[model samples]
Target: MIKIFRITAKNKILILGSNGQLGSHLSNDLAKLGEVTSLDRNGFNFENPESLDLIIKRLSPKFIINAAAFTNVDGAEDFEKIAYQVNALTVKKLAILAHENNAVLIHFSTDYVFDGLKEEPYLENDIARPISVYGNSKLEGENYINEICSKYLILRTSGVISKNEDNFISKIINLSNDRDELNIVSDQQSSLNFSGFISQAVLEILTELESNIDKEKRWGIYHLSGQEPGTWYEFAKFTQEISKKINPDSNFSKIDINPIPSTQFIQKAKRPKYSFLSSVKLKEDFGIELPNWKKSIIEVMENNE
Candidate 1:
């Protein structure tokens, strides 16, 4: 039996980090379902707990989707405090608030929570051994939410790319425009996903939960990302090839892509060498299918063109 919440067509919803790439897409799709209150940087600062509390109280939303994170991988090494505050502390506070109000909270996480040493894809139940400050902080945040909030969904994904925002795709296009060749990390491996696709899936999950509360099969951490996994170099090469078709007249040099080891890429923080997550659980449990990395990239590029 499906247990439906007492929700009308006008249920108020709040989207934190509504200005981010994923958040932007989520906010747009969620608008189709109900009255969505989108909060961008100007309105929502994750560092301020009291302000966040007040915002949640004022909105009193039935669903709170947090898409914001201190995503600067390298920057997180130097700014661990800020990263923890935004990624871990804010999520903890949000979880508490959600539990208090009996509201469902959906949070986005990353594959960085794993050490990335395994040859096979990571499962949701796999041991998390984050190698960097960013990964550790995010894992802490996920743990806090699981410990504090009874009704929450934590989604852990990897290698996010989008055409509409300040992400890897745009950066590559912009950089390639100026320079003939670009060097992308080749050693690290994971799935690449579009922001729009992620948002759509989130909306589906939320709708399912709201419509069928008794559906015990509709909750928990689901690995949501691209299907086929590839190295960053392969992803970059595909991007360049795709861009050539989109901008034939543009003079871009065919630069040699060097596949270097993780040790070669010097950075403030360490990274998971293999962070690909297995989608078997999500597929088997939720009947959700993640598209292949190449297919997702092509679709996103074509959409932009």
Candidate 2:
């Protein structure tokens, strides 16, 4: 036995991109259960390759979870090189460093790795054929982690709605305060994963990893995300409807929601027509079940209040 509980006390964990929405929540959640050191743009810049290797060798954390990514979908189209540098190259470096230190690397990826043409939910083994630069870069990053890191866990999710300082949720909440109606895309379908929910999943992984520290073969990629799938428009309506309950006087519920196809919604980067991911594998292996979209919505709404 690896003395799982003991490792929790002795192990050092580092979280990259601690400033973003998902990162912020994950940092807070992980800190409660173990020793956690978080780095954001202020401390670590993915663009600067020099800092990455230095930090990894210096910290030698037992667990390294990278929440950092060039998330600007449209911006990625214009800054393809930067996207590759930050998304793919940095992850590769991190994986290499983690392997060298005998640490376990846990990375977050996106459902955008798929082309969205698939009629059903995407499985972990599905062939990744990205239609956009961001998606391709994310897929590349996943590959790097898989190839370089001896022990690793790559979680793929989509429609990540978090309460961090910056995210789609905060943006929607802000805009809802200003406008009565919001236009959201209904054609694209994907599951929504809240930051809080993801934090719980990470905790579970750490708990399991501590117990099986010696079981290196147990390490592999998994799908950690929400269960119920919905379109951007459907999610918006659910969000707005929930907001009205919190702010009864607010007219978010009254907002006119129009379901528009992906073609109608013009964007600099192309999104998968349907990138919904299935949580079957995660549930089977980890005994973890994803929360429903409505349940996640209520949780975020309540947290905001």
Candidate 3:
């Protein structure tokens, strides 16, 4: 059943996965809202769910933003058990804990939850059919949250990148420095979102939620991914283009990025050929429109320099 939540006593905001790129940004930005507590996943054990119950009860947060996730797409295929435990089961525990504590559980999800079968961008309520274990695990987590918690949000995003973390853009720059060319997967289509963008969006959502806590329409899954849709090849090429424009004298400007089919780039996991997410719901509901991939790439490239 859907239960509307209102923050009464404990107004602390707890941020999980404090070490990640998005988590780090969120930790810093959300502090302005209220008393913030940032917890790293390593500090607690997900294998034993009961251990977290004590910790969360002590924290007594009004808002629990869970960013900790097992995001290794390829590694999930090998460590399937651990992946499910960390991504799904642990998230289920979080939902239950938040429901008990009367806290709004804001969780981060992924575009991988949808298989790349549809040509159009995936929406919030679209039927999800994941192509990989990582996707399945994340979907399971979302399902648990939906079933267990009423005052919660599931923000589905794509490849979240930033200069502060070792993301795709940073990796592309590093590879270009070492190798003469980069062969990126062109057949796959998705968006590369900036961590800063996501953090800011979350901040806005938190502000709105705090102001009006009983709005049932505000709680649910929302797409907070990049506005622009492009293939990996396009992302890489844009990275090179921006890096070169930013630092023309650097080697980053000289390296070439080549496009190849997903088959050419062999991997244990199968990625969605198209998982570009549409943020119309987020904008329509929360009045937040995420920026384009090009702008985010430019910011990351400039920071790299």
Candidate 4:
């Protein structure tokens, strides 16, 4: 059953990491519901934890959506401490603040929390076994949120792609501009989520919360992603195909995609072989079905063009 929830105009909402790919979209969507106070990296520095208390105390927002994180997969390998500080320790502090203020904390988590040993898509209840420093740091953050925050929603997503930022899809598009041939990993498998779609889905949940429709059932982790699972190579090819149709004069039309094994690619951090998330729980609970990856890809490309 699909439920439409109404949000009051005066409710205050604070969004951290407002300049990020997902954060940017979320800020725009969330602004419609209530008063939105957005904070970029400069506004809320994770490195300086002491300053957070003053910001949270002063804002006194009813909801705090944290989209900030140290998301450099390869870079995390070289700087585990910085990753842990930003991803784990800072999340703990935020969780504490949210708890003290009786604010709902909506934190974004990654699919990398899983080890990718399972053939099937991961469920919200699946045991997390992270394989890299980046994954471990994210898992630690999740643990902190679970421990400290009673009113929280941990949304686990995978391969977040956006037209406005540097992600998997944008990287491929940029690379195609300069190179005729592109090599992408075929072994990695996950669902690619669009920032716009994700933000809309989140908006639905927030609306429900405002209406007090599903207040009791909303707190906890949920898997949100595109409908189908696909490999990196397949995603790149689809992007290329769509890009060619959208912009025939673009260099993406001339690019030849080459599939390569994960082992062939060298990187500082290890990625999960299969980390696709199942959005069945999210659909059943929120009554929102995520769009297909192809639809999202096409929409993003069309909007950017």
Which candidate ranks first by TM-score, i.e. highest?
A: 4
A best-first ranking of the candidates according to their lDDT comes to: 4, 3, 1, 2
For candidate 4, the per-residue lDDT at 182 reads 91
Model 2 segments more than 4 A misplaced: 1-8, 176-180
Q: Which candidate is the best by lDDT?
A: 4
lDDT tens digits, residues 1-305, model 1? 11122346666778888777788888789877777878876777888777877777877888888998999888999999999999999889999999898778889999999998996889999999999989999999999998988778899988777766566667766776667567788888988888878888887777777777655455677888767789988887887687678866554325555677777778888888898998888778667777888877887777884
Q: Could you estimate the TM-score for every candidate?
A: 0.92, 0.92, 0.94, 0.95
Worst 10 residues of 1 by lDDT: 1-10
Cα lDDT computed for each candidate against the true fold: 0.81, 0.81, 0.86, 0.87
Model 3: weakest 10-residue lDDT segment is 1-10
Clashing pairs in 4: none
The clash number for model 4 is 0
- Model 2: how far is 293 from its true place, Å? 1.4
RMSD of 3: 4.5
Tens-digit lDDT track of model 2 for 260-292: 777877899998878889988888887887797
Pairs of residues clashing in candidate 3: none
Could you give candidate 4's per-residue lDDT for residues 38-84 as a string of tens digits? 88887878877888899889879889999989999999999999999
Q: Write the per-residue lDDT of candidate 3 for residues 28-81, one digit (tens) a residue.
A: 888778777787766665666667888788878889989888888999999999
Candidate 3 regions exceeding 4 Å error are 1-10
List where candidate 4 sits over 4 angstroms from the true fold: 1-8, 213-215
lDDT measured at residue 138 in model 3 versus the true structure, 0 to 100 = 97
By TM-score, the better pick of 1 and 4 is 4
